[model samples]
Target: MRTEEYAMHDHRRLGRELGLFDTDPLMGAGLPYWLPDGAVVRHVLEEYVRDAERAAGYRHVYSPVLGKRELYEISGHWAHYSEDMFPPMRLGGEEVVLRPSLCPHHALIYRSRSRSYRELPLRMAELGCMYRSEPSGVLGGLTRVRAIQLNDAHVFCTLEQAVGEARAALALIRRAYVDLGIRAARFRLSLPGEGGKYVADPELWSRATALLREALDGIAYEEAAGEAAFYGPKIDVQIADPAGRESTLSTVQIDFHQPERFGLGYIGADGARHRPVMVHRSVVGSVERAVAHLVEQHGGAFPVWLAPVQLLVLPVGEAQEEDAHDVVRRALALGLRAEVADPGQGTLGARVRAARLVPYVAVLGEREAGAGLAAVRLRDGRRPGAVPVEELLGRIGGVARARGAELWEAS
Candidate 1:
């Protein structure tokens, strides 16, 4: 057997080879079409994050991808961020634009009703699809795309709650990275400095930055000048790929300007209306980028729980075809993503080679079929002898349910 590595670790190439996703010239650049295999991985990740957010007291909501131009204007995106946003479209005498961020919409939700101090720290979450007018030259694979689905959330809380909320956001980021086996090389406290891009409020910026610092007291992070958004100071979670290239995958921002601009307020215990602070957080900044990162991080060999095709069943010959079908049925019944390879498609060795990237492979032969067993082959070069169909089901199901990063041992 020959073992080698590609000179260029491009996700575009890996995505094609794995049948994950693709882009078309006719469809336009930076717009990726998620193939079935790719969609499965995305679905798993989305569900995982959704459950995590729910447990963290975030109430999920669905918001439109387009909003009135004035919404962004009120949120300060129109004056400061219009260049990166798509040009506004006029419809029925009203100008609308594809939302570049979910912050404004979330602020609207918070202001839809009269909130009180008792309901402070209202966490709103959404897997929001957003669009940006990215330059064609910079568009590359899933990492940099014109359209993105962000794992985004915003918290409207009192000043006293902002610090705790920021710390909780950091904890969520750490837990997510740990679960996905991603290592953040460093954290960066991005502050506004000598830039017209930031809101001109020294006191707000100082207070916001200090709150972030207090929340991150024991955590290590470096200060980055002028890296913040126009509306806020943020903490960026930076990670490095195998090639030593680094990118920010997660962020927690403290926004003091948006609430004031939108007039977002809640009744305080002192019987007065006070502006609430907004905390913007994303566990995985972009689902597409996260997939690209994982593809490279694992060299396209995804863990069983996240693998597009967790198991592939191969029939040794025509006589075992029924057995292979049965295996697939059993696997599917247990919620395992499994399929049977065409017996006539290729030789057993060729078929096995074709499925090497899959996490698990089950070879069904005359002996195995008669005994109601399967010869299991693991991607890690483990060839476990024939095992009962029921046992194999339990093993695969257990690992998937547990979100285990490795295959279960066949004893």
Candidate 2:
């Protein structure tokens, strides 16, 4: 598609057209309310990431969006990141602020209990909420919203294990991108640059930078000074939009600062205290931006497993309503997301076209309904001949369960 026309497929427009999300003046800029469809997509994405984390031995945690002002002071966010953070709010006697990051809370979780060297790699994950004080001009759809739901995780491990953990995190990111249809435009070794609010620890910075390089050992990446997080160096996975504008969608960072500031320590094998290194990584950084990118990447035609409406059932006429609904029920019972479009809504052809982005469209007519079959039409315009309802549901269910990128499950 031409660039001008491709702009129409931008997530902002698709959000409105596809009932994904929207912004209201009364609600203010930089905040968008996700519509029902958008919420479904978000929920699915969160669940997928959570499951992935769990399978990788990461324990999930929940942290409040607001933290005591003292928390940020200790984490160094107040000193270096206050410009981008929302101002503190007074609650009774204590001052609290909307957290700009989840690292501080995760750090506290780690400190909550005494740790031993046996749990050296304590992986903690959360689909947490955070906010930014973005200017209106910089705020756009889900891409640049002030309210962010991040798929964030932190790995607290021994210095010897930090590089290996970082590499594992990067591998997980690559796997996620392949399934989500995201193409990384580049991999960046983000380092602190001149004039940046970087932690003034030269030795720590040098060591962390070297560790990240080891994590990205064989991967080709350009070293970009000044692009690193305030605390440490990172490997940033970059993706571009249809218009060729690029942004970071995933990251893996090695940090030696937070543990020191938070006084985090674990009992060593020799029965002495040792500071554990912290590694921060996000397979898909912000859920909002990730979905926005996916919207544009597939033009709202998400992979079967990620589609808000996996299957749309259309009845050829009122006489087929019962059969159409039956098909929907069977699909739903098989753990598929299915919906039925009444014959009264529109013509069969019109209904199918209306749901062109849906992964599967099952048309039930009197003839097919009598034979207990459905004529399946795929989003990419393939009409898989009529098959028994049970068989069709089973195939789609298998694909969704496998999180298959293609409409058909691989043999």
Candidate 3:
């Protein structure tokens, strides 16, 4: 697509132009409803995340959206995120609340198994939909929402292997982010404040926080006092957009207390009972928020792979409609996201130009469909011409599977 054709304001104009999702006052403003197009975009992101995670040895799992209040009381969620959680429901005298995170559910899953040391460093992931009770005013398009689906995971490992697993997760996150087009990064190693801002044992906090620092020995860091979870230290990745605005996009946290609280244990090498350390990470934060960042980062030109509609065949007129339809049908059959533009809408040049302005779009008509070729324009700066379908498919697949900040060029 031509660089000059893309609107620089597209990042903010997403809600107005794409209208992928919307929130209503009567339905409670902070929540968003994903339109068909938005769902397609989100699905693209999530599938990408799943493939990345699987490559990193993560096993996916499904957990409940709500848990008993007692569960949070045990995992420290109530003390830390109660304000962000939905009010508890009295279920036959027991309190239940919508979950704000996936750690507790993952811990529960661990407890359900009588794990051996061989299963040490067990990594479980979930792209499951979760909920919180964020205030209405905080909601902004896909950036903030009361309900969200997270790209979350938990790694349970022995104290000795904790750092190694953390480093692996860090590498995994970095790989994903880099492939997705992230460039400059801020690695914030979070710690406890001086006067006991955290909820765990003070000495433990000091020792654990320092341990994290040691793990970050070579990497540049900014210390964030009181920015950690109640039980441990965290490494947060804050991304810089083209406009220079920064936002926290990914996080990896280590918890020393929660596994013990739930008695999630396994037999050690010495045949002794041992509590595993838990590392909770949400590499993409929330799909809602991640999409917001992506919109801003590339200014809505979501690389060829992530584009909601991979290609838009612009037929010159009614005479070319059959060819365009054939192109669209073949693209769909091959599992590619492609569509056809309306010839009656405007001039052929105008239609082609409009399609190019979107993240990923192509003009496939008369000359090429008959020639069994595709006219391609990439989100990165490639222009039209004809190419074999298999060749184009392979390149597009590579782009879709890519993760990280370097995934796309800036607007």
Candidate 4:
């Protein structure tokens, strides 16, 4: 697709047309409500990340969306990152704020119990919700929203193990991008610039930056000062919009400041306490932004595995309705998101057009339905002619299960 066409594939317009998500004046600007279809996509993506994290030895955890004001104060967010954070709310004499980051809670979780050398590399992950106090002018669609569901994770590891952990996190980010078909615009090493809202610890900053550099060893990256988080330096996986505007989709950072501030440590083999380095990583930074990019990346034609509705069954006429419904049921049984386009809803041609973005469309007519076959049409304009119902289901299911980029080749 042309660059301009990609720009035109704005998620805001496609979202409404495809009935993925919506926003309202009464419901507030940045808080978008995902329609049923959008919810399916988001759920699948989140589950994928969770499964990946589990396989990578990351223990999933849930933390409250709101945190005590003193928590951020201790983490230095109140000092260095308060502008982006929502204001604290007075609650029965104590104050709490919607968390802007998940690291503080994870830090507390790590410190909840005494740790030994064996658990040095404890990876904690969460699909946590956090709020940003974005201005009214910046509140756009899914890309720039007030409330974010971040695919966040942090590893508390000994200083010696920090680089390896960060490298592993980078590999996970790259794998996710390949599976999701997202192209990285560039890789960036975001560092502390001349002067900004950053932790003023020279020794810790230098150590964190060097570790990130070592982790990014052979990878090509650009250095951008003042782009580092308040606490550390990070390697950011940048993606571009249709207009060539770049944004971070994934990141791996090494932080030494938070552990010191939170007084986190582990018992060493020599029977002494030592601070563990914090590796902050995200496979897909924000679920909302990832989906927005996916929406534009494939236009509305998502790959079968990620597509909200993988299969659309269309009956030639009312006489074939039962057969169409049966096909949908069978597809559903194969773990496909299948639905029949009701004959009463529109003409067969119109129905097919309406489901143009769907990865697979099965047309059931009297001949095919009677013979237990389906005339399958792929979204990429390929027709494999009429095939037996069982074979069609198996082929599509296999491809979807494999998360392949294309359907089975036509025979």
Candidate 5:
């Protein structure tokens, strides 16, 4: 409540102090327990991911959070990225590993069926909760938790369709960010390095990387880089926080070697079996990391749709309580997450304090009952004095529709 006090995201101490989430020392670090409000934000992220996947023709499937250990071995993941995984467990005398990525599981899905050329580009998506046993020091808040909910998926397509899939993923990420009014992200066409883990032959990496690069031209990135995944080169959507830290939040990696590693193939139109290229892409990165980025980026002042509660109807007194209920009912009917603050909680100052602390567009005062007008205040502790209740609702609804960064940008 002090003017100089930084928000929870601005001050890590504040996040833990506020009870949004928790990190435990006894849990061996990088682990978090989601409070009820934190869970709401996580659910919001999944909804965004699902909407994008559906529009892009991705079929959703729920896969087990843990996969048999041999599955990673067969996919060459154990050989390269094993250190990131938790210790394997004994399941029916076989080792089972908590999934660190979704590609291997998705590969098994593709392997479940006899392939047809008509289904060359099979897009499979899952918001798979996975575990990566990062050492204690690597976990910081939600940004680098040991447990991760990954918005992960894969596109199994004939080599010719790989570029199209990559471009589609790029378009979806850009569109989602633009619609959210986030113009800070920069897409990088990550290229392979000299002696990189790319499919051994230099020519294949160059060709595939070049093809993906061509798709990124004119997309307006802050810069490009030679940093790439081991299997292939692709795009990494690098985002920066206000604190000047940069991290890749979404990635589209072209994996030419993985299909061959697993002997994956489909009947081509030419009537012969051919290896399909696998594009591993994630739109929101680890939901934990995405949440951390968003918290810091907006200083924990989330936008309307992303906000846990879009608005809090604040009645000035007992007389206006029914009208406050009316406003809350209307907001809820319109599908904007709305709630009526407990009138008995405390004085008006305490009500405003609670609303501001929880980040809600607070509607206050008696004008709301007189002419169905509203005394509007933002979650950021901004009061718009008084305005017509209908007009206030329209304004807040527009902001929520666009997922605006703040409720009252004009004021």
Candidate 6:
């Protein structure tokens, strides 16, 4: 397809064409339902991030989606960001609101027990679901949804450890983007300026901003004055699409006010209690937005590991049905996502064309079945010709395991 034609494979169109997701007006705008294929992709991505977090010494936690209205008030979000949050719902005697961020909840968890300096750098991670009252004019597919599953985490540490924690967070974001073949278009140091949206304490803001600068020193980034969050200064990693539209995919913020506001503290080596500095970070900002980016980045042809259907077994005719089923069984045993195309559904060419969206397709016929082999065809038009079943499995399995971006090394 021409580049212009291929650009039409935007997430909205591809989501419908591939049966990935859907939306309904009756249910509500900005809410999406993930179909089976899309759910598989989501599951894969979520597991990948979970494993990465585990290896990084992050302790995962599950927090409620709703909290008392006073919780946000303590976090200072009620005063600064009330316009973006869903209205408080009165349940019985208490007013509850859908949580707009996980920072406050994590802070509450840290404050639940007395902590010491030895446990200073506590990393809390969650796949937290949040709701925001986004304006109808700005809601666009998965990119700007009302509900989001944020790959959020918070690090509570002493002021001395804050810079290292920020660096660690940035490293995680770099590794994730590299593995997923995403290009970091630019780095932005968003700082507070004359805007009244920022926290009122100038001294706290100055300290937080200085720490962020020290952590980001030697890193190539441009400063954007007046773009900081209400409670902190942040480093935003912006990713550009094929059309050069940029979106913030990863962020790390240094927060000083929220910790003090929430009265979160740990006993220092001097035997004095001091508030712990909080570092807020997200490697893949929002899982839904990540999916949208990947869908457009790969043009619906995901990497082997991320593809909903990694392989398709197409029998030339009904005579090779058993062979096709056998191939699928073997593929499944090897942990490959494979499906057998029904020969009775349509012509072999038509079926192959339809299944071309999948990464690999194995064609089985009387010649190949009798020879105990199958002709492997790659979607990228690389025909490796007839190969033994075991070799085919090994090759594709290796690619899936390695999460290779290309079908053939030469290609």
Which ranges of candidate 5 are over 4 A from the true structure? 1-11, 17-19, 191-204, 219-227, 357-367, 370-372, 379-391, 404-411
Which one wins by TM-score: 4 or 5? 4
Q: Any residue pairs clashing in model 6, and if so which? A: none
How high is the CA lDDT of each candidate model?
Answer: 0.90, 0.92, 0.75, 0.92, 0.76, 0.90
Question: Could you give candidate 6's per-residue lDDT for residues 1-411 as a string of tens digits?
Answer: 556865686898898899889999986989998999999999999988998999999999999999999999999889999999999999999999999999999999999999999997999999989999999999987899999999999999998999999999999999998788888999999988885677899898789889999999889999998878999889999997667788898999999898888898899999999989999999999999999999988889898899999989989999999988998899899998999999988898898889877988999989999898989889987888888988888888888878777685642
Residues 153-202 of candidate 5 have per-residue lDDT tens digits of 89999878888888888888777776544554577777766653444757
Error of 2 at 205 (Å): 0.7
What's the true lDDT of residue 274 in model 2? 98
> Which regions of candidate 6 are displaced past 4 Å?
1-7, 409-411
Taking the tens digit of each residue's C-alpha lDDT, what string does model 4 give over 1-411? 476686569898898888999988998989999999999999999999999999999999999999999999999999998999888899999999999999999999999999998987999999999999999898889999999999999999998999999999999999998899999999999999877589888998899888988998999999998899989899999999877788999999999999999999999999999999989999999999999999987888898899999889889999999999999888888788999888888788888888889988999999999999999998988988899989988888888878898786655
Per-candidate TM equals 0.97, 0.98, 0.89, 0.98, 0.87, 0.96
User: Model 1 off-target regions past 4 Å?
Assistant: 1-8
- Of 1 and 2, the candidate ranking higher by TM-score: 2
Candidate 2 residues lying further than 4 Å off, grouped into runs, are: 408-411
Model 1: per-residue lDDT, tens digit, 100-206? Answer: 99999998889999999999889999998999999999999899999999999999999999999999999999998878878898999998878588788889889
lDDT of 2 by residue, 290-377 (tens): 9999999988988888899999988898899888988888888888899999788777788888999999898888889999999889
Decide which is better by lDDT, 1 or 5. Answer: 1
Candidate 2 matches the true fold with a TM-score of 0.98
Q: Model 6, residue 31: displacement in angstroms? A: 0.3
